[model samples]
Target: MPIDPMLYETQFFGFTPQTCMLRIYIAFQDYLFEVMVAVEKVILKKAGALSAVQVRGSTEAFLRFMKQRFDRLFVKMERALLRLVLSVPPTVLLPEDRSHERHPQSREDFRLLQQDVERLQGRYKAELGARRALLAELEVQKAVRAQLRKTLRWLDGLGDAHGPPGLGEMMSLLIQHSGRLRSITEDVAQKSSGGGME
Candidate 1:
């Protein structure tokens, strides 16, 4: 004898339909935390490697690697996060008890949830924008550092016999540019950490 589909559905999970949806949402949140940790490790590794390398070519390569990794991780993370959010059940308040009229509290709760969802979406977009801007700035810095290294190499080729020109002024300019880059990076970090961008 064939079993009924409803019997299997009811017996397998042993949860009401509404409860199951909530459970799924909770599970997705747990998985997101683990994925986030892995992505953080990747970023840290790339940053450390870029700092240690004095060679312009290697530094550029490291930065490129970081950009690629960030792009891939972000795509996956966004899809998963969006899916979890979209899965949340809509708030519905029905007057199940005939003795009592519909309560205003239900409408208020629904409005609050709607506001929360909008706020979360706004924060997610801001975070994504900040990440993209930071990546672009890092690319620009990489190009500047490569050009500086090339200029230094060319100067080295001009022997001590020629008595190369003083680079004190150039060094100062480079230091200023480096400082600007650091400031931009720190600002991005702060925005991301503070609740402005998730």
Candidate 2:
């Protein structure tokens, strides 16, 4: 007896093809999380080695190693995700496939599938942008903190002859600067949360 493509499709892709596609998408997401966790462990281990480096050359070597590790991990992650996305049955489904046309609802189902793929892509791009912004903001905050500490140290060196500012005055200035920093932080957070593609 000959095999029927429609029967095979119904049996494997489910009555509603979209449901099967969503199941595959969710599975890929779960696999991505696992890969990320594994990469993070390796990154953390590299980060730990940084603290023990006393020499400048050793410190530079560790930094280079960390960067290389991250670069390789990112490349591997991209390839893996691309493979998973491409391997999805719906992604490979042909518009002219007669088996897919067995159900009159297939067109609408494919439209919905396209929309979901677009949404997921937009979300992934937005997340990547947000993370980059956050990292830049954190770097700025770290520099600002170092400068604040230096200023405080310099203030402490000023003797009473200069009638060093009262503790209250110093604290008031610090509070003003802190408020500005907090405002910038909040703005970044808000933009990241609301800047998703429509």
Candidate 3:
């Protein structure tokens, strides 16, 4: 049960202020050890003389005085209990999830991972540049092949006309050079294909 409204209760038969105070003291010692300190300060101070006067005085006056004392003690105890209940513990914290907590090891690992990624990016760029250079070389070889075909056609025309004294030797030399250029073009094409670039 909620204990706020539960003040000290005793039957009127053989009721006395000494009995009531003793009951309160015993209760304090049992359930509220520290609250007993407050009780001594609040209720039990000057209690001996107060109880003597109540014993000689009217029973109604004694009842009123005892009720006032109980009320004051209860109020103090309630405040102490409420402060205890409502107070936050020192270790308690908001945002208890620690999955993303950054320790030194994790941070170092992240830095190393970033470096590896950057190294891979640099290698990829270098490979791309090499591929572009190879493609340019292939284009140059194609142009050379086209030029050699035109020259062979011109040499054939010259042969039909039987022009010039060294014309056949020049034509033979041109054909041999054309064959070497074709072989070089095939080698470059094969190298480009064998390389891993797309």
Measured by TM-score, the strongest candidate is 3
Q: Tens digit of lDDT per residue, candidate 3, span 50-144? A: 66344444444644576578678876765564345433344543343233343335778899999999999999999889889877777766676
lDDT of 1 at 123: 100
Q: lDDT values of the candidates?
A: 0.57, 0.60, 0.58
User: In terms of lDDT, which candidate is stronger, 1 or 3?
Assistant: 3
Looking at model 1, residue 62 earns an lDDT score of 57
User: What's model 2's lDDT at 119?
Assistant: 100
Report the lDDT tens digits of candidate 1 across residue range 94-188.
33432334434577888998999999999999988988877766666666666656655654664453565358855765675667666656665
**How does candidate 2 score on lDDT?**
0.60
Evaluated against the true structure, the overall lDDT of model 3 is 0.58
lDDT of 3 at 184: 61
Model 1, runs deviating above 4 Å: 1-105, 160-198
Model 2, residue 183: distance off in Å is 13
lDDT of 2 at 59: 44
Best model per lDDT: 2
Decide which is better by lDDT, 2 or 3. Answer: 2
TM-score, candidate 3, is: 0.34
The list of candidate 2 runs beyond 4 A from truth reads: 1-105, 160-198
